[model samples]
Target: MGIRGKDRQIDNIEFNVNDISRSKTFYGSIFGWSFVDYGPTYIEFSDGRMTGGFTTGEPVRTGGPLVILYADDLDCTQLRLKAAGATISREVFSFPGGHRFHFIYPDGYELAVWSAS
Candidate 1:
């Protein structure tokens, strides 16, 4: 299966943490999430029905986890977000599985949109 059927849907949630192992241990013990390490800096987690990730690539944030959405066409989605008053916080960047960009919505919540490469 691919992301073709999940266009514009809430896809993954991500957290920036100081320690990936600690986060994995905590979530695994508390919520039974299973994790797959990508490298020293990142790990993917699955809680049965949903998937997310923890990364040490960024500083530990205080507000909340980043909510990510999937788009079949990243550029189109970005344009729509911009026209809806979102501020592009980060330009598109490639990760392991896809490319994504960050944005801040009107109320100051940061989110991301990704499309599979």
Candidate 2:
């Protein structure tokens, strides 16, 4: 189905880790989360309720983890974030399923907005 705007779905979350294998094993053993390995540096998981990913080989940001949200209109979402005084940390980039951009909240938390559009 095509995406529709303004819903503001909190679709998934992602974390940057120093070791994908270690994080996968730890979380899997503790929470029984299942994982899918995209490569040596990337692994996705489902915690039975929600889906998220662990990333390695990249600079993990300092403000804890990344929270990702879904938007139907990527451009409008970004504009709204900018208008709200959020800092654009990363410009829009395409991944396997969609495109996304990272922004920093006023309190210094980092988040991302993504869209299939």
Candidate 3:
């Protein structure tokens, strides 16, 4: 058997903070989330179940937490998001696991839809 892909779920999340060290300490104390540093600017965290990351970067252009979702049909989902009035903030881009695009939801929060296929 082979591994299965996570689809139609909140697969990952990212947060931007001005101070990575401070954020790390706070989250660690409060939630016990463990982190692995990537560099001076990024750190990945494992909160027992879901994995997420933190970055010492400027706030996202549109603002809000970065919530990434999994989709089976990437193109169709993009079209549907557009039709539903979500603005495409960032075009589809490929990463190690798959491709994804960022959009501003109707409520003005930014979210991403990704496909592993």
Candidate 4:
């Protein structure tokens, strides 16, 4: 079989954060994102073709909200994400069978990702 670019979905994204190290650990714990250390400037969490990164920079807390992704395990997810660098605008304790967290992009845009399982 031949390889094609379109065959793969968006696996990773890098959003600037106030502190790279903090965010890296936070997102990793929240979503169980595996972080690959990339020197002193950056780090990535990749699940095969799917990946995301955290870098040092100020994030935006404006604009439209972010797309939330549901998870099978939310309690741990929240704890992990919080450790990374996400400020829990809303804690994940009373949201049905799932929970979520929020973060700000460098563009002042607010977005959230969650899981319900």
Candidate 5:
């Protein structure tokens, strides 16, 4: 909860979503993330390691930042994301360290998932 030991590190990430409930449900199902509501307009989520927030306080905008996630099984994660109604924006591609793919959430935020396999 405290970032005192993490100087100059990325602390929190927030997403402006159209519907808080819908965002919670989608992210919860795909990543097994847990949520805590601050109010009707905002909710915080934890993926057991990192925490972020879903907020309806601002309008949803795209093309800001790229949030990349790690997955042990890239193919399976991609399948789950697609099943959860996310659109696959980029096909799986290989890079120096691993393979990755990008997906666009309903709110138009683009995120990538990568694996070492």
Candidate 6:
């Protein structure tokens, strides 16, 4: 194989829920989403092509829903997020060859969609 620096890709996305059972039930009932439980507080679902995990409230809501977005350029992604009314919390910063931003939605909930640039 030829030598390469790296390739950017998304592993998965996560959504925070105050109630895991309720949320899981809702998704399963509505969209027929199947789930795998890591524990009582965690559950994962395959919502269409998107795969996301759910975490129940145990510690606290330090942030909000986390919707993952894969991109080659995190800076460009930041611009789109800002335009969409997401309040910037963490700016684009390179860390170990990746960049990410944490922002709050219009609902005053914080979430981050990270990308490796």
Best by TM-score: 1
lDDT of 2 by residue, 1-117 (tens): 346443588888889998888888899999899998898778889998888999975687776778899888889889999999999999999987889999989988888988887
lDDT of 3 by residue, 1-117 (tens): 112466567888888888889989999999999999888888889899988888875474345568888888888889998999999999998865678899988987888888877
Between prediction 1 and prediction 6, the one with superior lDDT is: 1
CA error at residue 97 for candidate 5, angstroms: 38
The candidate that achieves the highest lDDT relative to the unseen native structure: 1
Q: List TM-scores for all candidates, in order.
A: 0.95, 0.89, 0.78, 0.39, 0.51, 0.48
Q: What lDDT does each candidate get?
A: 0.92, 0.86, 0.83, 0.53, 0.76, 0.68
The residue-by-residue lDDT of candidate 1 on 53-88, one tens digit each, is 999998877899999999988898899999999999
Better of 1 and 4 by lDDT: 1
- Weakest ten-residue segment in model 5 by summed lDDT: 1-10
lDDT of candidate 4? 0.53
Evaluation by TM-score, superior candidate among 3 and 4: 3
lDDT of 4 by residue, 6-117 (tens): 2112223556656777876776678666777776656666755566656553353333213444444556656766686666665554543344566554444555555543
lDDT of 6 by residue, 21-80 (tens): 998889999999888887877888986776778886334455555655555556666787
Question: Would you list the clashing residue pairs of candidate 2?
Answer: none
Model 2 stretches astray by more than 4 angstroms: 1-6
Q: How are the candidates ranked when ordered by lDDT, highest leading? A: 1, 2, 3, 5, 6, 4
Model 3, stretches more than 4 Å misplaced?
1-4, 57-64, 95-97
Report, for all candidates in order, the number of backbone clashes.
Answer: 0, 0, 0, 19, 0, 1
Q: Show the lowest summed lDDT stretch of 10 residues, model 6.
A: 1-10
Query: What tens-digit string does per-residue lDDT give for candidate 5 at 4-87?
Result: 343224445668888999989999999899998888888889999988778887678675535667676778888988999999
Task: State the local distance difference test value for candidate 2.
Answer: 0.86
